[model samples]
Target: MRPLQAKIIADLHVQPVIDPESEIRRSVDFLKHYLQHNPQYRSYVIAISGGQDSTLAGKLAKIAITELNAHHTLNYQLIAVRQPYGEQIDAVDATAALDFIQPDQTVTTNIKSSTDAMTLALRDSGLIVNDLSRGSIKPKMRMIAQYAVAREYDGIVIGTDHAAEAFAGFFTKYGDGGTDINPLWRLNKRQGRDMLRTLEAPKTLYEKIPTADLEDDHPQLPDEMALGVSYDYIDDYLEGKNVPNKASEKIEQLYLTSAHKRHEPVTIYDTWFY
Candidate 1:
């Protein structure tokens, strides 16, 4: 490791940004306060992918909803929606996540039809769609499905995006990354696992490898394999650790190239008024 990178790593690790117990309290309070301030939103909607991030966020939202219901006259619901492109091979994990979250309502929305329709439309328009392009549709469709449920229930969609994945831009833009509220925005993958343990999340959820499950041809591909870098290195880099040169360069490239995913849509101004 270079001296500068090593020094940065040492500094970052010396003072951690996340504390499990405090983060839990702050997150739960943030959810409650956010809903209270935004009266129109009566529920919280989350896409439960049976991954550690989602499970942790969903469980935190559930706790906030329950606490709000107890002290306030307003009734808040935590709606966990399972969106599968087709038949989910890891259906058991999703089921287990729901069991642990115990959301107020559960909805299953299959996005295969919608994705197919979009692909067909594009094909009819004389565009040759490839596997990678086609696979990107799944996360966008999932976001659409989640918003549909949230709209119906007067809820805001909750996101599980965190520092580790955000560093690599390891999410579909305006897709799984699209959400109204993100309670787990600052936690890294390691910190997320710690939070899950603190919340007493099911062991299966924390133990399982993270995957986007978006590829139709290679559905079982893990996130690390897809990204060409492992979470350990990602987390270390995120914490300002000195990772190998190859890993560091790849991480920097991903973060730089995918910067657009972190921002809102860009639009040309029609006119400037003085």
Candidate 2:
């Protein structure tokens, strides 16, 4: 792994630099670069799950929209989408998300059919025992639905993958991890939340435990439970706070174990040279 990615994965939780203005500039630069490079993605489709991460990403997109226009008025669209899995947690998130970004601009699409297809495919492959335990199926289904929406609206997919999640590879590669642009890639969880607060995001989103809303009974299971620790613990350890012995140990283990996920695939590129 690159030293910076390793250092962040191991210890990046710290007090924020507290420059809201700087954050805005950073976000603007990121979005401008992405949109400029990917001109086909003039419109943006954000997978807003109403958690702090996505909420903050949505806020940043709004800021980027204006900032982009200020530099030169351009005709572009920002779509805040809620691809619900029909879970109660997701339903609530979808409802709350509309208030934050407004549904007229945000499309709430239920992806139960896609989720069902994934379960059936996994079951046939013997990778899944039953319908309810289809963990990997959900994110993939959600991605398909979001991308369909993005294509329908001629937009590019946007996501909120912060440094911590990226370090841990907490997201399903090419699923929720797939995006044309990510505004929060460099920011840690706390920094993402702080940016949302700067944009005055809804209190519900800010306070809610982060989850991907895969199952109603296991709304929190899809993400938080899988991580084996909350972002708070992860962030605190990264920031160099004194964590409980168990949490400290877990943090160290996670950083070590997930280090491979942060790097390029090991390859025989040197075979020809050798």
Candidate 3:
């Protein structure tokens, strides 16, 4: 692998050691500590989409706040927000995830009305957005909903981004990617599954194919097929495991092309931007 790519893996801390139990405790502790320090925040909020990343995160946040409530004077809650765009196509999966988390409270913000309004306004103004661009709007709308809840409750927004997604830059920038905390940043897809197993989350949550569920025309397309590199391949690459030459080259190229997503929006001070 190229040195730059190797450096990216190292920086993400995707090691071969798989310690789900320890990682869970560490993440829970991390959340508790952050909330304790920032006493102004009364809770941790996460948008659970019935995916492994969000499921694990919601579980951790619940554990953290539950522990804090029991032991500390201050009361905190883990608010699990379900931001469905119209009727979420995978409503069953999302329901199962919410049941498993059993968060202190749950909030559902149907983004369909908001998303449609934006699209309708755009068309009225003699402009239109393609499917891919329209899909990005959902995540941003979801984030807006999450922040609204967080602000209402004096809480923090927790993101589900992990090493594999971060390296692939598969997230919508300033959308689902915008958050105050991420407990799974060091983990990859496989590692996330291991954590879910440790948490005893519903097996189906991890077993089902992972999809961004973004593009309307292609509905429910697997992320690997969309990205042109399997999660196993991405996970292997992140974990420093050797893979086919073509896979490595393609993964490296993906890292290069998506570099912009990995960083903050460029401004005049960004020397590379001009």
Candidate 4:
């Protein structure tokens, strides 16, 4: 490996910077401190899609709320939300996740109506809507539902974006990637599984293949197939290992293109006017 590539890989490795137990404690503490300091935010809201990342984050949030309630006179809670576009094929996994997380409250919101309405409006405006664009609506609509619930309940949306996804920029901007707090932001996918194991998360969560459920016609497509790279490769690359050249190049391309998603919108200031 070249020196620059080796340095980038080393920089992305997470295990050197994370201890599962300590990370869990820090996440819990961070949640408690955030809620305590922010008087308006009364709860943590998580959009649970039955994925391991969301499941793990929701479980940790629940634990934090429980710990906070025991020590303080706070009524903080964790709200696990399920936003399916229609009848989700993986609804069973979502149900299982709910059972495991055991959130303080649950909300089911079907996003089909909202997405369909928006698509129709866009079509009426003389725009062509393709399958990929339609699929992208799911996460955006899910985020909308989550924020609506957060507003109603005075809660902050919790996100599951971690180092694995961040390294490849594998998340939707202003969608699943949008959240008020990201407790798992620093952990890689493998580290996330380690945390799940430490937290005693369900075996199903750690064992299931990750998917975005974007293919409406075929809902079972694995995320690796969609991204054209397996998470194992991504994780390995992020852990400072020598990955295949193709995988490394693809990762770099994704990271570069999605850089905009990871940052706030750029705007030029009116210096002369000021």
Candidate 5:
């Protein structure tokens, strides 16, 4: 059984050429609206990695701040942060994104020690400790940094994880996968790319290979290699089409199996409804 099957309820097939401008607009609007309506959070903290997904998310957040400032004249500010583990392009991307947005606050932290701590904690757990899980240690460390920054700044962590990653279970639980707000939750990679293009994000970000920079000089994992199928094929199967190839079949099964992660925990009701 694959993880993807249980997570997806319906497949909405959208062509690449389809106009996603409206979708982008709606997503941005929703995030802004949520911020305005929710009084608990004072600011928004964006984890800027300079990848297309995070870059796009950061741009949209900037636009939201601009919109709110224009109408309400609030004192809210966006905070751009980078948590560098091993040496890689992540910090470069984070710095570039910070320059682009000129966040009201910026901070960088060396989280290698924290990464080690997380790896040890995971080892104590009973789950099988594989390379992928070990690789997730850095992300867990970054999540701790983000949460600390969020508390200090009276804000919440914003994320760029989209449907594709969620469907594939590519993120670490309570790590990079956890966020106070996710503006890209509904959008998949293709839609995310479209939004990035629409927002005129940096070309380098779009062109750069996707790497999380967990390990020093860590190589980026391709979607196919990581998930046993390509994102394009997963996207197709998730959209309800009968996936023909063997790769697609395995991907579909994995997606279905991982569906439980996307939803709230299931619990037995103490009392039946009348």
Candidate 6:
């Protein structure tokens, strides 16, 4: 009851049909406008994971910085951060994304050492930490690494959260979900790929299956399989297309269960009655 599912599509500003080129221009223009208003910002820091969301975010950020430099003679920078736990299974795709983004700066910070140290400290304190719990830490660590880079550069951390993911509350709270601004907040996953194709993005990066891969035991698992529902269905629902009752129910259930992720931390003054 916290979030009326009926109002979600409108709340997220999801347009069922969109012109990729127009959306791309709009997002880029929004980024430029944001920087113009906030003159103190220096760079746009993005985590390039070779996935559709990050790849698109990075591409748009690079374009923003590049255009600012070309037109306004600004010294803006685009910092692309690569945070892999140990060895990324799809390093090739990540490389390809970086090749496409060609960010002004690329920072590779392997979070393995820090991830392991936290695990050890917890275990030493006589607490039992499961693999799934440890796996969840990777995203938080990656976020930490990104923020560290942003803090050092006085940059704004760009987030990849879009309507579909935000509607389902699919991101880890304060982890992959934490960011300064969301340029892709109104687009869905399919719309994101459409923009990518319009931008002539590498076919491999957009075509590659998206995975959180938080389960160390099961590496490179597709997001649809892990979520128990397909992106097509989520997109359909977000687009206001009629979907099966079962799929709709599952989507709503996911949204309800993960509702806390969508809000700030609860406080004593919070009102829960609905």
Instruction: Note the Cα lDDT for every prediction shown.
Output: 0.84, 0.68, 0.88, 0.83, 0.70, 0.87
Evaluated at residue 176, the lDDT of candidate 2 is 84
- Candidate 3 error regions (>4 Å): 268-274
Give the count of colliding residue pairs in each prediction. Answer: 0, 3, 0, 0, 15, 0
Clashing pairs in 4: none
lDDT (C-alpha) at residue 56 in model 2: 75
- Name the regions of candidate 4 deviating beyond 4 angstroms: 1-13, 16-18, 269-274
Taking the tens digit of each residue's C-alpha lDDT, what string does model 3 give over 1-274?
6576688788788877779899999999999999989988999999989988899999998999989999988778889998887777888999999999999899989898998888888888888687987899889999899999999999999999999888878899989999999999889999899999988888999999999898889889998898898888888888888888888888888887888887877887887433
Model 6 CA RMSD to the hidden true structure, in angstroms: 2.1
**lDDT digits (tens) for residues 137-212 of candidate 2:** 6777778778988888778888777776875777766678777777777677777677667777777777777776
Single out the weakest 10-residue window by summed lDDT for candidate 6.
Answer: 1-10
Query: How far in Å is the alpha carbon of 240 misplaced in model 4?
Result: 1.0
Write the residue-wise lDDT of candidate 4 on 224-251 in tens digits.
8877888888777776778899988887
Candidate 1 lDDT by residue in tens digits, 167-263:
6678888788888988887677888898899888889999899888777778878999999999988787767667899998887777667756766
- By summed lDDT, the worst window of 10 consecutive residues in model 4 runs over 265-274
Q: lDDT at 82 for candidate 6?
A: 91
> lDDT, candidate 2, residue 220?
67
Pairs of residues at least 3 apart in sequence or in different chains that clash in candidate 2 = 13-238, 13-239, 14-239
lDDT of 6 by residue, 93-204 (tens): 8999999999999999999999899889999999887887887788889899999999999899999999878877888888899998889988988999999999999999
Q: Tens digits of per-residue lDDT for model 5 on 82-175?
A: 7666565456676677777678788887787776666677678866656666676667777888898999988878987777777666777777
Best by lDDT: 3
1 or 4, greater by lDDT:
1
The lDDT-based order of candidates, best leading, equals 3, 6, 1, 4, 5, 2
Q: CA lDDT of 151 in candidate 4?
A: 93
How would the candidate models be sorted by TM-score, starting from the highest?
A: 3, 6, 4, 1, 5, 2
In model 3, what are the clashing residue pairs, if there are any?
none
